[model samples]
Target chain A: MNDSAGKIKLPTTILMIVAGVFMILPFLWMISTSFQSPSEVFSKWLPSKLDWSSHERIWTGSYNFVPYYLNSVKISVISTIGAVFLSALAAYGFARIEFKGRDAMFLVYLSMMMIPPQVIFVPKFIMFNWMHIYNTHWALILPGMFSIFGVFMLRQFFMSVPKEITESAFLDGAGHFKIFFRLVLPLAKPALATFAIIDFSWHWNDYENALVFLTSPELYTIPLGLQNFILENNVDYNGMMAASSAAIIPMILIFLIGQKYIIQGISSSAVKG
Target chain B: MKRRSWIQKQGWIGYAFIMPNMLGILLFFIIPALFSFGLMFTDYQFANPNVSFTGLDNIERLFQDEQFYSAVRHTGIFLLSVPISLVIAFIVALVLNRSVYLKGLLRGMFFLPYISSGVAVAFVWMLLFQPSHGPINEVLRWIGIATPPGWFADSDTAMYAIDVVQIWFMLGYNMIIYLAALQEISAEQLEAARIDGASARTVTWKIVWPLVSPTTFLLLITGLIMTMKSFSLIQAITQGGPSGSTTILSLFVYKTAFSYYEMGYASAISWFLFAVILIITIIQWIGQKRWVHY
Candidate 1:
């Protein structure tokens, strides 16, 4: 119905802007309080002076926030790389290569998507603890490597590749690895990038996994670290805001950079049955 | 012999490609899910290390447990926000679908909160909903309201307050999906309807809505499943406090297992939760045929 993209509806635009402001006010309040002194958190809605002490303290606080940040980076990077690689391989196999029971196997893989992590976390926790990997980065990294969404998304992209191109590569004596790396991977860059951004942010924003798996402060991700920071500094609204703002920045930056892909990925999967 | 050779080669390569993921899922997810059922029937404790068979005992305990019922009730109450949020999101998406100025910028603004960490959003909302000094209360006071409800602190209002936060958090996601669905509606149909003297409202209600029913059904099922299993928001904001008004099933299973070390009982409760979700999903699946035009 909105085929007239060049024509701007003034009233609807005004309504959207107002709604946008309503959506953005809480975030603005967060950034505002983050720069205020602790004394001004309740008294003033906006900070008069931009004080950097809250950021300074969180950076050098007793929590040793550096390691947590590093841990998150390491965990998210490794998990994204590993998950994307494995998912691509699996997707290539499922999409391009034929095997016995391939459809059945893919159906099994797809069904795993319906099982929420809560249904299995209890036993996984016990298993990890038994394996003596509890509270370690592997607990997060290893499990994050198994992503149903990654495989599913990549498969959709892979299936779109023309069969003739892959057959031509096979005719040139290229093996599965060579074709997957050289032919399919390069062609599926958009889908790969989409899944990468989604996976990275998901791992970055993960709190429940980190909460359940990591008990040590040094092993915490930003979300878990911010949780602890909130517990101890509940009254320290300035520091809490600063920490929350910091925790949110990386994801926000990623979203801004890949806004088109993120929204596309969301809509592509969400609109489909 | 040639065909057999090709089939064998392809099979080996296919299995090789999927080996890592298959192994990982097997170890982490598949096995754990199998163990979940086993864990439900056994008295497994972390510290004690005394595993004994107790068939159906955990399920019996769940039936008798009052807090389990409370968690279920709270989950049901929280899930009511899905319909509430659907209406809000639908209306917002309709507005957004119009030819509006600053479309990209406004859409990004609405979506910013969705990408932010749940903990951060919950913490920000906690500050906003603070009883006395919060800006929301300040606005209420400015309007000659003597006192506003203590949002998370009062048991009566705690669940609804959390529902408000959830609805706000999910509104952007739902709206984006609805917007996409709306945009997918073919212009030819609308043009024909307009030529037939049908009004815009009639076109929207009769043609636009039915065309988007599939997406609506998808959103409804996913939204219900998500809100039912939500934990981090409750954990960060209220921690299921104020007399257990916000203790949904996820929070209940978490606290029972970790806080109280009742692994067996927690496993059972989680299964119960799974059953609830499974049943609801099946019901929705069957019901969609009536309303889903596709």
Candidate 2:
């Protein structure tokens, strides 16, 4: 932790700040442009006056973003909860229970991470269409509720839970379900929270899946709805930026609140894999 | 009898625990993947309900598809982003690890783009790269450059333009990974190197780089796979436009399957994609043995 290497600290600090500016400038520009009037949007770097028309239009005008926001919240929340709960169950099984074919089952689950979803996108579309859920929120939410990555991550955390803890519970005649719910799940909250944040953000930003699956505008998530809004209002940068800022605010807030978990989740996955 | 019953009870517990997820994956993922493989050999258009089996016809057509090759080329070009992002991320992580002031603030700023939606990222960059009125060109003009390449609009630079955005998007994720690994390097070793009067460059190269190779390998593989399958940026930003210069394989697959409704052809294309991803993943597994130092 003693990182006071003074010789090159100033240069490194300055360099990182410059690079940080490169990273954050676009986001700052996004928020700035959203507040600019149409005439003032491209004329200057900063808005002359904070025009609320773009935000107002997106909320009240014909291009209402309320449905998109609500739908994104619905899908992300439902899928995040479902994925975490189900994956926790499976992780407990894989980590604690002496089940037949458990290792093989886990290997298959891990392999799911490598197979890019593009390969299955068409067929999943067909399947969802056949199931009469193609245009519904079910199309967006159902397929995402089972994340192999979540299972893989949580299983690692679960396995790290001391054997004696589980063994002692087992000796007390606590069944797998009882142990999972009463002990392991509580202990794995950090890992669960990490995966939850990840899953939520992934589902929130999922435009491609929504684009492929959902056809009804009413059921569209924010990403797909935003895309439609952009195409309809491509020349209206002010309005587009406003709508985009609205769509991105929730995820940004989530990241701000739980970014440590996000970074921890990612690095742990990397190191373990 | 007791042992057998206990074994049976344990099996039931395990099944109960795993059933919800397994059922979902089986119905949603495994079934669709298998059905897609079956569709690859058939001529299954969305309009025509009667699907006719056409063995190898789709594969034959895929070989002759010019857009497919164009997409493959664009994907290969985009793959350059993995190494580019890895190096940039590692350097940033290294520097950020050294300086402690406002570390969290700087890291959060760098990571904002990655957490933002693709639509937001694509739109913001598109506005920034707007040739006439955008700020990038304004800066370029002030610096005495009369014309900047019409980013995302000009065919010659469209792919590179997309690559730059992809790199920027990936840098934060990769940098976080590298930073975690770099910080884990023992303080004692760094102190030892300093006491021995080793230069910063040597310390980085000899100690820091080797220690972080495993993370670098992990980031490189994940980055490559993510970039290979990435299409949202193209969809939102360029729509693989400017004469298909930015058309990656995922976009092509999406277009073929949905836009054209050529499910069979799309399935074949996807199979090809699956094969490529499998090969790359295999290479990662094998190559990690050589370069990844645990």
Candidate 3:
């Protein structure tokens, strides 16, 4: 039995190590190719020198990444903050407070999650044009702030907070606004953090929406900037790779910092689903 | 009586709290959704006020359109990656469920792709599959194959290349979900199966596999839905080209509306996409009873 167990370990380790390498090979390649010269990219496995030209070109050129990077951070951060606050407020109402037809209304809101965002691009285009927000960051940020999933997830979290806590707070003659800001929101910090992190990453990584809405080169987010880089310098693999590398730095930073909640959030979503 | 009055007062505040989101949803999502249904029947060019009610013309064009048919076919190929990723993720989950070295690190590495920017992911793979001297083809030639597929450069092979990226992209997410389900399985159940003189294969098939079928079911339905709607990676990599061979349904909708300014035609294509999603959802609602072991 011991001998058999030892034998199985070798193949499993080899298999896992190989899979692990495949998982990260693209990221490694992104960094490696970014630093390699055009001539040496396909020829060399790793760059011979730590090249800074590609990285330098992005900042100093006519098309700078400064606006793109700032746009991404600005859009995602604002969207995340608004999403957390508004979702928590509404989810608090649904989870705790009672009103006429509340359950029925909540059911309607929940069903909207089933509607894929692709189905709306046409009318949204018309609507945004009419509203005069087309081709602006507002087009992305406004709709982005309202995540149905965030409301649902935070509702679940809020529901698990004992009702007695809310009841006792109510007895102190405090209004719903005060109780929410003073009691529920503070208690649901972990849930809020989880949603904020997830939402931030999503808006940060959002491409199709940003692609459709933002046409001006200056208003573009990081993903849009990277796509612009690709289109402008189609075969400039070194420059494209450098831009792509720069694009994911914030995401990697977020992942490293909040991976615990990110993983937990994913797991809980599966279990809950 | 006083307490009852206070409860009634709180109800109005509930509405106040919920009003902003409710109105936003109604305006942004519900209105647009209903508006698209209306647009499906119109000859509305985007940003052009000259609109005509060409009832059913767009829908008629959709059925007769050759590009629509190919988008459907590409969507079928794209969805295939979901199941393929699920199987591989399940196997990996089972392996890592046991006492594996660097399990946490491996889990994080795999999940990174799922969370990474789609454009970045697409660009890296484009370089790797750079047909002539790109590393993937180079390695294929090195391994004794005289000719290799022209991945993104060839119309015939582009969809399959996208599948490889989709599979890689979804593997970590599927694995993480599977790992969660696997952790829920009790060890005593596996021990009991082994004690009954069952081989490792028997234990896995009869015990572990059955236990995670619900996760499998959940991932399948959601993954299929999510993968069909995925656009960015394909948009960045090929933009439905080397001749539009990789144009899945969502990309087709994007092109018809934004690229061609054919809002009416795009609405028709997207409505078809929604109908397909509805059918899959209905199937999951019904099919869960038959095979999704709780």
Candidate 4:
């Protein structure tokens, strides 16, 4: 970072700024278009005056996003909590306790990560339908609870912690559950936080599963609601943009709050993998 | 002996710890996976349950279908984003790794797309690339091009347009990873290269790039895998439209299963999709040894 990076050259700096602008242009357009009146949407780049009507319409009109936002919150929060806890529990067990065929089972579990979620949608549809949860949020939440990637990522983090810490706790006559709750869980907070944020985004942005499983508009997540908005008002660019903005603004806030964790988590996951 | 007893006893509790998650995996993942495999040989439509085993029939259709081939081709085009994104991200990361202004803000800007919901991304790109008067074409026209490409509206260019979105979506992740790898390179090494009178280009190509080959390899494999599996963006925008042009394999499977309720055929295509991913992964694993420095 020192001798070579004394100063950024002009061309490189210009190129970087250009790239950055290109990256953010769509987002800016989305936000700006949301403020344009419907008649002025395609005619101009920026609105003469920012309109709040489009934003207000999302809540006050027949086309409401309140239910979708609430459902997304419910599913992402519940599923993320359930996924983080379950993955950590499994990861801790695999990391700490020595059982026969444990490595073999973990190996099998690791291989399951390659099987794309798309492959099993048909059978999941069948199974969920049979269980009478097909049109329910449980269809998404139940499957979302078990993330093989979460377990795998946490297992890597857990494996790096000194075995002696958990081993000594065992010698103190504490059970695995007690140590897991009291010691291991507290120690793994950073890793757990990282995995929780990752899983939360997955459930939050998930369109395919919600599109397939949940039928009722009342059961729609943010993605489904956005789609329905698009279908009903393809011509209403301002309204559509408003809905899109509403959908992502929370995620943007979350990213701003947790960017440190998200960056660290991504790097660690890549390097360790 | 006490420790042995504890180890033995805790082994049972290990099952307890993993039990809930394992049960979940079985119920939700493993069983469905196996059921899909079985359904590949049978005519199992959702809710019309007169199931009959039709061995090899679905496979035959997969190999013969023109749309299947188009999906395979679109998937290839979609996958082009992985390397393109990696290259661009690597360049951005190299610059950002240096003395740059507002580095944190720029990094966040690039990464915003990856974290933003796919639906918003889809809609935003739609507006940006809207063929008639979208900003992109307006820029092209302003630059003296009489006819710019109809990005999402035209079938011929639709897949490439989606590739652009995918590349933008993945750029931040790749940049961060590459930045991490760049930081790992010792300052002394770069200083040594400069001491030998090497140009910055030579230093980056000969020393820095080779050193971060492992990160590139990691990004390539993971990006390829992830981009291959992702279809929600395509589903959100175009939806295999402009006459079924942007249909990647994942979206194809989604449409087949949910839209048409052809579960058996969908399962078959999905198995093929799995095989495609598996082969790509195995190829990457074997290929990594050739270039991955670490």
Q: Supply the global lDDT for candidate 4.
A: 0.88
Error of 1 at B178 (Å): 1.9
Query: What DockQ class does candidate 2 belong to?
Result: medium
Q: Give the Å error, residue A269, model 4.
A: 0.9
Model 2 RMSD in angstroms: 2.1
Candidate 3 per-residue lDDT over residues A1-273, each given as its tens digit: 335666777687778878888898889888898898888878777999989888888888776899999999999999999899989999999988889988998988866766777889889988998899999999999998898888889998888899888877787788899989999999998888889988998998899999888889889999989888888888888888888888876788788888898888888866765
For candidate 1, write residues A135-178 as lDDT tens digits: 99999999998898888888887887898898777767789899
How far in Å is the alpha carbon of B57 misplaced in model 3? Answer: 2.2
Worst 10 residues of 3 chain B by lDDT: B2-11
Clashing pairs in 4: none
* Residues B120-217 of candidate 3: C-alpha lDDT, one tens digit per residue: 77888999999998999999999998899999999999999999999998999999899999889888888887778899899888888988888888
lDDT of each: 0.85, 0.86, 0.88, 0.88
Instruction: Work out the TM-score per prediction.
Output: 0.95, 0.96, 0.96, 0.96
TM-score attained by model 3:
0.96
True contacts kept of 4: 0.73
What shift in Å separates residue A87 of candidate 3 from its native position after superposition?
Answer: 1.1
Docking quality level of the chain pair in candidate 1: medium
Q: Which 10 residues in a row give candidate 4 chain B its minimum summed lDDT?
A: B2-11
Q: Residues A128-241, candidate 2, lDDT per residue (tens digit)?
A: 878998888898788889988888899889988998898777767888888898998888888999999988989988878988888889898888888898788888999998
Comparing chain B with the reference, what is the TM-score for each candidate?
0.93, 0.94, 0.95, 0.95
lDDT of 4 at B128: 85
